[model samples]
Target: MSDQKDILKNLKTSSIDRRLSIAKASFLAGTRWATSNATSFFSSEKDKEKKRKQVLREQARYLVSEIGKLKGSIVKIGQMMALYGEHFLPREVTEELNTLNNQTIALDWDSIYPHLKNELGSKILDLEIDPNPIGTASLAQVHRAKRKSDNLDIVLKIQYPGVANAIDSDMNLFKQMLKLTHLLPQTREFDQWFEEVREMMHREVDYHLEAQTTQRFAHYLKDDSRYVVPTVIDDYCSSQVLCMTFESGISVNSPDVLTLSQERRNLIGEAALEIAVNELFVWGEMQTDPNFGNYLVRLAEKSDEQDQIVLLDFGAIRQFDKDLLSVAHDLILAGYDHDLDKMVLAMRGYSFFEQIPANIKPDMAKVFLIATEPFSSLKNNPDIPEGIMDEEDRYDWKLSHLHNRVMQRASKSMASRYFSIPPKEFMFISRKFIGAYTFMTVIDAKTNLRNMITRLN
Candidate 1:
């Protein structure tokens, strides 16, 4: 097995053609396995189905391994699919793909120093950089460092050499895969979504923008005690290199977090929900990337404050259409009132429906209402009553069976003829919403989310 893996290692070339070649080989191997397994020699129909699933699981695992080896924008796409593709792809595929979120390998320090030297010049020599990165991702790796002048601990985010340059090629390759995989409906809407993603990817590679965005968020969230946005150090930053005050905490989903008392977990979850609400409704500007790695759970050492959630990575900031908030408010109110007609009108106002069929409109309304059901300020729903929630407020992830319902509704929604992409204006914010919701679920957060939003309004 080691020898077979070594063969794969030898072929881990960064060249686009070589990477695709390896992918093609894996696909063919999966095909062969499926063909060989489909035989009359199987004892029963159940055995055949079991064999097919086993083959699928194997192929999915193999595909994940190969994609991790071919890191770049491809890995970024894989991460998105892992997070958002639950509604689009099979459960087995999504389960395997989600692993990519943490599987990216960083370029070694020997291969990375030159880029740092070029970006920071002699200042690089003055700073003490740790040999190993604390975090590695699709576009960059982060190393802990300290200044010679004051010994102030900081983090250096260094972008890979060709990641920015490879955006176009990577998108082209990803588009080709989409056409072949049928992972999404091949329509103008899908194409538009792809283009939006392409533009966002290109924007993300700009460290300058990330630095600026980080600084801006530091200001917006400075007064908020529950959240921490790292302060960017201007003298140490450049187009390809970002330097900021180092924040120490456990990963949001780390095993360490799961050990926290349920009360603490509820606090963290409430903080997270509030952060999402303020970003969407108050600021109207948001850091759209909600990768689990982007948040750190830090304990406060001060006298007054408790724990704080540290926000990291600001490259994907977006300004949403403020009017959409009003529309969303109306939709929720209508849903709470059980006024399907008003809810449909509000959804149409948000351009959620283009040519949606009449038969599905009622179901669609039901879907919308159920989604906002947790937000009901009405005491009728004992689970989430209207009021300032106590520390005991908790939202159960499994109670509503949201995962299965979302999967079903999304499939039906995409099947609609008039269902194009969601309003382009929400292309990215919707991703943020889904990601934040998932995070809340992961933490087993108990917060009246609607009340959180209500307090702000």
Candidate 2:
């Protein structure tokens, strides 16, 4: 009875007042840092600017540390700010926050034990759980365990006591902070983007829902020998706890992976590309967060020399509506042909541009085409300029300057009356694509990504 009361009390603590306190602390720290830095003397104009940048960097680090200590949806928000919000934030802020990506600070087991007992009851005594967690995530920490019944080794994901309650409190405070700091455009469209994020956060905290999502994805990929997904152990799962078979492997970008032969790396890369295309085009769903921590590589059971991929954490699965999927297909097709008019029509239908300037529409279309460059082939469009794709079909990510071109085009679009947020669904899906593309670029993995698209159909 006391444990139940404690759980309720803990959730109450993650209220709006607490969230506001965190936000207030951050704002106060920022103000102090800026004031002190600005008042300090410097030898020259260049030195002053350099010192100011250093101050900003230190402030950014402080913000990351505080959020890490807070440990809940706010940590997840810090992560998104590091990745997608980079455009809206100071470069120093985003660069410093990037260090927190997939970095989790776990709660001590004594602090976590009450919730585990509440959820699992006497069954807790029948299981052998490690005192320390194997890994920690924004909402939960994963510990290795063994079922006493079948002697089965499994992984248990235990949510922080108040996270579900904290979602709304954290997000509301985050929204207010963004408005206060001018990190997001103060518009109805941007508000909708946040509403979707709020919904996603709520879903992510529902462990039962995550279990179902993981099961569905396992079924979806079961036949594919190239990938592995752990089976959910249903009897032990609850809204705040999840149990699954244990699977281990090397991190996707571990030094050992880099030591593999070029041919082996190419196979892994091609497999990754295939997964992305099939998920978006064929499955009509995706695991939106593609952090490298969510992936692993293991030696193939049948062939020691070959490697297989293991996928983890299905909390961010998103399903596409038919209309959205159709728009995506049209945009991709138009982009391949470099058909400006068709591309514009497709994008407009998707609410990408409420009112783009007539003069800049062609440039917008070109930018969209450049985005598809990473997934395109000269075989499909032989007339595509040489630098974008080579005879060997390798997409030259660096040579194309994809990120710079997209941002420049977006800045131009923002200057025009065309400014409107596409629905949150589109933004999240695009994020998945970008995450996959960036991972491929990091490993310098080459694949005729176009060919993988055909396999989707």
- The TM-score values for the models, in the order shown, are 0.81, 0.84
| Cα lDDT tens digits for candidate 1, 1-457 | 1233322222123556644755584556546564756563555888876765666566667766766777767777767666655434566777888888876566767778887899998878779999678887877889999998899999999887767777777677655544433334556665766676787788888888888778888888888888888889988898889999998888888787877777778788878877776777777877777878789999756657678899998887777776787776676676455566866777665555546765677667766665655555444344332343344434554355554565466557633433234565554556776776788678766555656645644
Candidate 1: which stretches are off by over 4 Å? Answer: 1-60, 86-92, 177-186, 254-256, 259-263, 335-341, 357-359, 380-430, 455-457
Q: What C-alpha lDDT, on a 0 to 100 scale, does residue 358 get in candidate 2?
A: 59
lDDT of 2 by residue, 1-457 (tens): 1233222123224576566666776686657665756677655888887877777777677766766666678777777667665435678888877887745556767778888999998888889999778887777888899989888999999988877877887887766655544344666665666676778888888888899988988998899888989999998898899999999898877888877776677678888877777787888988888789889988655555468889888988888987788778777877665567877787665545545665677766766776776666776565455676668887755456566667676667633334233456766777887877776666666666766655433
TM-score of 2: 0.84
Candidate maximizing TM-score: 2
Return the clash pairs for model 2, or none.
Answer: none
Against the reference, the lDDT scores of all candidates come to 0.69, 0.73
